[model samples]
Every structure is written in structure tokens, then in C-alpha cells.
Target: MANDAIPVRTERAMMRREDNPFTFLQQEIDRLFDGFGRSFPAFAPPQAMMPRMDVSETDKTIEISAELPGLETKDVQLSLADNTLTIRGEKKSEREEQDKDYHLIERSFGAFSRSVALPEGVKAEDVSAEIAKGVLKVTVKKPAPKQSRQIDIKTAA
Candidate 1:
């Protein structure tokens, strides 16, 4: 009896699809930014370094907390102006290892800026910030509600 060999098929690497100008442009732009990120160690891609945040509001205060692991108070800046609360910071870290056969050093750096628009009547003096255990806490005191006063009509002079 003669043994028959089974046929095996292999697929090609390229798949056929309709050419799209917009897709091509988008892909090119993405590649550009990716290459730029790889070339510059100090600059991170957009939204890459955005810290996780939690915001809460009560009758008298708006509290915000951001998780900024490995960051210290000196590395962060907080400001309020024009009814906007801005948080800015730069993170720099380095690690070094030395052995008899090999020596290695690694560094990482990135900057981040985030802003939150405060509700009308929130003043800079009413805001406070504190940092501890790699977490940033911000408190905004809401302004007291103004009472409407009735005005009396005057006769023409």
C-alpha cells in the first residue's frame, strides 16, 4: 500500500484592503509621534504621565486627590488663577547598579500639567494643598451664597 502525503497551506503576511488616504495620514502621524517619543527620553507621549485623580464635592468644599507615586512635595506646584486650579510637576528618577562585571544606570523624566476650572466665586485664598505618601490633596472652599436683596423704586427727580 502507498502512503499519501497531506497538503499544507500557508497564509501570506500582507492582507488586501482598500487604500484610505485618511488612514494613511493618521498612521503616518502616529508613527511620527512614536518615533519622537523614542528619540526624547524627557518628553513623554500625550497623557502618558497623567496621574490618577479623584474629585469630590460637598456643600462647602471641593476636594481633589491625585496619585503621584514617587513624587515629593518639592516636585509639584499648585496654583489658582482666573478661576482655574493648575497642578504642574516634573518627575525625575534614576537608578544605578554596579557589579564587578557590569555597571548600569537608568534614568526617567517627565513633566505633567493639569488644570481644573473652579466654580464661580472660588478664590485662591480659599484653596489649600498638601502632599504626603505620594498623594496630593487639594481643597477648595466654596464661597458663601449671596442673599438677594429687594430694591425699592424711587420717584424721578
Candidate 2:
């Protein structure tokens, strides 16, 4: 009985690593999307997904600038964590028109989020954000570099 079980165990151990359950599922999903896109090209997105951003750093501060067109100061929010910064915005727009011959109305809204990883020296508490002309700028002061101290230990005489 033991000799018969050994061959089955060996065959099971010979399974390929790429045959992992999650990886197999991902490959199947990718294949489905490939075929679906060939059948219907309109399902593709019309525009880019997220807003464009620029990140720069100076001697004492780091700056992040994002281009958010048609957004006001109150439409965006910022948050910071350990070496990570997050920006979220809600774009709510509305329009109305009336005339003797015709009338029309339009409204649209969406929410977007972007997260960035900052350098090691940034200070979250000193971060600040400002919006001007549809551009959002965030500044974070760089903390002073940490110094290492050596401790001395004495043995009993």
C-alpha cells in the first residue's frame, strides 16, 4: 500500500508552479478580455484614466503638482501617511439652457483618486496643499536627517 501511494504523491509534487490557482484564473480572465476586445472595440475607454501630475523636490521641501481642469478649491481633498500621499476629487458639473424655440439641460459628475509615494525625509504634519487655476499643488517639508548614537557598556571588574 505504501509503495502504491508514493507514485501518486510524486505526480502531485510534479505540478508546475505556474499552475497556481490564482495565476490560472488570471490567465483565463486575460484570454476572455482579449477575445471580447476583438469582438467589440467600443468597450475601450475614450480617454486616459487619471489626471496628470508632476513631482519635484528642493533642498528642504517636496512638491507635487496635479493638473485638474474645471475643478475648484473645494472639490479636492488631500491626505498623507507614512511616505504616501493621496489626492481625491469629486467633479460635479451642471448646465441649463432655455429659449423660445428650444430648451436643453446637461449635468455630469465623477470621482477620482490618486496616491503617490514620497521620499523618506518628508514630514506629514507640515504638509500643505493649494489650488490655483485648476492646478493643485502640495508641499511637504523635509525632516532633518536622523543621527545615530553609540552606547557604551561596561563589564563588572
lDDT tens per residue, model 1, 29-117: 99999887556655655676788789999999999999888899889999988888999999885655656686432334578889888
| Clash totals for all candidate models | 0, 0
- Which ranges in model 1 have alpha carbons more than 4 Å from their true place? 1-44, 95-108, 155-157
lDDT of 2 by residue, 21-82 (tens): 88799999999987764454334332333678999989988889998888988889888887
Q: How many backbone overlaps does candidate 2 show?
A: 0
TM-score of each: 0.64, 0.58
Candidate 1 vs. true structure, TM-score: 0.64
Residue 126 lDDT in candidate 2: 83
Q: Which pairs clash in model 1? A: none
Candidate 2 lDDT at 156 equals 90
